[model samples]
Target: MKLLIYDHDGQLVELEDVSAKTLMLGIRDAGLNLTAQCGGCASCGTCHVYVDNAWQAKLKPPSELEDAMLDVVEERRESSRLSCQIELTKDLDGLTVTLAPGSAFE
Candidate 1:
């Protein structure tokens, strides 16, 4: 349930045991403006984020559809992943991610 947030400002914040929330929901609940324009259905690339290398191996890889959608995101990178696709878990306690610039709901 721990969330390691890489904010728009390039800062890392660790949130502890935040519940079984999706990454996008947790970000919003934490007062961050991560966008989930398609309502967490994995439709849009608005919630695009870059998973830290250290945690990448621990996460489930994005589906083919997700990888396709990520191509449309601005500043897409090798580590890019949609926040909505990331489910919170105890093993992800120290998971780190970076918010893509201009991907916030605002």
Candidate 2:
């Protein structure tokens, strides 16, 4: 349950063995404000974050709905993924993700 968060302020923090919350929830619980406008249904892009290069390939690819939703995200990138769509798991212990500026809830 480790989390590598790239904060909106350009800082990276490594959080270890967090609970099984959705990535968005975990980020919020960790004291970061990430927007989940559509809840965790994968319908909104406000929760978008760019997963680190080394960990991207290890994640499950986005669903077609997620892919479509990502188009609305500001600064969308090849590694962009909706945090709400990401479920915490043991295999994601070292996951690194970059929080897009202006993407999280202000």
Candidate 3:
């Protein structure tokens, strides 16, 4: 599967091996920045990302924990989501999202 991630600079970075794991795990395992300090715990907003508008509805609604966590994201948008909460499924094979401002490797 392929995941197109737009960086803070609006550059496109493609991740090709999205296995059956959370989007954060796939992206991080690919050696990308995706901070994700909370490690899929949905407690930190560090994994913030914005789902491309066209692909927003294709995802399941966020859980309560994620919803609460999102409230803390400084750059949260209408389509903002925590990558740790999204499962990579065949249905989302070509998912596209942009890493929010605070999501950095360092």
Candidate 4:
């Protein structure tokens, strides 16, 4: 499985064999700045990302907690998702997401 992330700088970072790790960790570890203010606790919308529409059906529906958090994000969209709430797995191979403007850690 691979994960593709569009960073704040508009550069794409790719991670191979993405499994177990959450999207937030993968983004940060790839040297991209994503503000996980609550550290993957779903308490903050800082880790928000816009999951590509093509891949929306591949992911599990967001939980109630995640919905509440996303509701507070000004950039919320139909594709919006909390990076911390998505875990990487083989099923998500080729997953791609764009960091929401307001969620950049830097």
On lDDT, the candidate that comes out on top is 3
- Compared with the true structure, what per-residue lDDT tens digits does model 3 show for residues 18-71? 674888987788777788997889988999999999999999999998999999
- Clash count of each predicted structure: 0, 0, 0, 0
Tens-digit lDDT string for candidate 1 (11-106): 888877687478888886787768778878789889888898998898898999889999899988889999888888778877788889768766
TM-score of 2: 0.91
Can you write out model 2's per-residue Cα lDDT over 9-59, one digit (the tens) per residue?
A: 888887776895788888877877777777789876788899989988888
TM-score of 1: 0.90
lDDT of 4 by residue, 17-106 (tens): 655488888877776788889988899889999999899999999999999999999779999999999988777888999999889865
Error of 3 at 88 (Å): 0.6
Q: After superposition, how far is residue 48 of candidate 1 from its true place, in Å?
A: 0.7
For model 1, name the residue pairs that clash: none
What does the lDDT come to for candidate 1? Answer: 0.83
Better of 3 and 4 by lDDT: 3
| lDDT (C-alpha, whole model) for all candidates | 0.83, 0.83, 0.88, 0.87
- Local error of candidate 4 at residue 3 (angstroms): 1.1
What residue runs in model 1 are displaced by over 4 Å at the alpha carbon?
none
Candidate 4 residue spans exceeding 4 A from truth? none
The C-alpha TM-scores of every prediction are: 0.90, 0.91, 0.93, 0.91
Higher-scoring candidate on lDDT, 1 or 4: 4
lDDT measured at residue 92 in model 4 versus the true structure, 0 to 100 = 81
